[model samples]
Target: MPKLTTPISDEEIRSLKAGDTVYLNGIIVTGRDAAHKFMIEHFIKKPVQPDEQELYDDLKELLDGGVIYHCGPVVKTHDDGSYSFVAAGPTTSIREEVYQADVIRHFNLKGVIGKGGMGGNTLKACAEQPAVYLHAIGGAASYIAQSVKEVLGVYKLEFGVPEAMWVIRVEDFPVVVTMDSHGTSLHDTIQAQSKEVLVGLIS
Candidate 1:
């Protein structure tokens, strides 16, 4: 399997193909519905006014060139108060379809990881921005957690543990590219082909 790391370059993303198995390393930020909504409403939708350099800088530092994981992990706190991921399976990605494109453009994100597939808008954004969508295996939460090496930090805990944005460091995190920067999507192809097959059978 090919390996990728955080701050992934545009060239590397372009080289990826749909159905490629990739082992990801380095940092990734976890975000689900609430986090996506918050980011879009506050950081992306709001115009960067003259006095808001700090706001822009903060978002850029956290998201630029990073991979956004559509995950709400189960974490455990140790005696020393450090956190560990007990289970970290991917959430369904289509839930964020409305906000994903803008988030990708605003953050200059390199990749997204989730289960199931996204819609046309996300496919367009990935193509235009040179990003890729990696699919993590569903129902394999505990297995996935083994790849997470460290809990760097977290944000927006007010949304509770499940929805909070968790910044984590992972090593050889496994995923498959279902959508690529070349405007190809394995999910889309499969769906269309399946429909055609059904039509032929019924006809």
Candidate 2:
């Protein structure tokens, strides 16, 4: 497991190939369907205040070749008025198959994180955008949640926790690289290889 830490840049992420293991630290935003829709619908051009713009600006440079964790956490505030992650499970990567590639390009994002592989559209998106896809272990909610150290901000809280965008700081988040910038997919390779071996054995 590669120990991944803060101040990560786009160049660093692009340099990584498929099949590498990474332990992510620092901050990453969490976004899903509703949050995605809202961001796309925000046509107001209201000119965000300086403080508000800071997050996205920082996000751009760091994410220029970094990853997005597709997680919807279970959060409850503490008596001290601080929040924490309860269950930080990876959402199915397929749900955002529709918007992922486009989002990756729009944000200049380098990689995406989720569970259960994504299909060809996203894989193609990865190829075109030179983005990569990462897989988090499914059902390891509590273990994964431990990595979330803080929530800096959130968007669309009305959409509830799962559908909202959570801007969080994490430490030592575990993930496996499953897709490459060149469009080579670990899932596809596994499926095809599995079939060939199974057929050979049956014959």
Give, for candidate 1, the lowest lDDT window spanning 10 residues: 50-59
lDDT by residue (48-118, candidate 1, tens digit) is 66665674576588678889999999999999988999999999999999999999998999999999999
- The models' CA-based lDDT, in order, is 0.92, 0.76
User: Stretches of candidate 1 above 4 Å error?
Assistant: 47-56, 201-203
Which candidate number maximizes TM-score? 1
- Rate residue 153 of model 2 by lDDT: 73
Model 2, 105: alpha-carbon shift in Å? 0.6
Error of 2 at 15 (Å): 2.8
By summed lDDT, the worst window of 10 consecutive residues in model 2 runs over 39-48
- Tens digits of lDDT, candidate 2, 48-83: 456557655655655665667778889988898777
The C-alpha TM-scores of every prediction are 0.93, 0.81
Reference-based lDDT, residue 16, model 1: 97
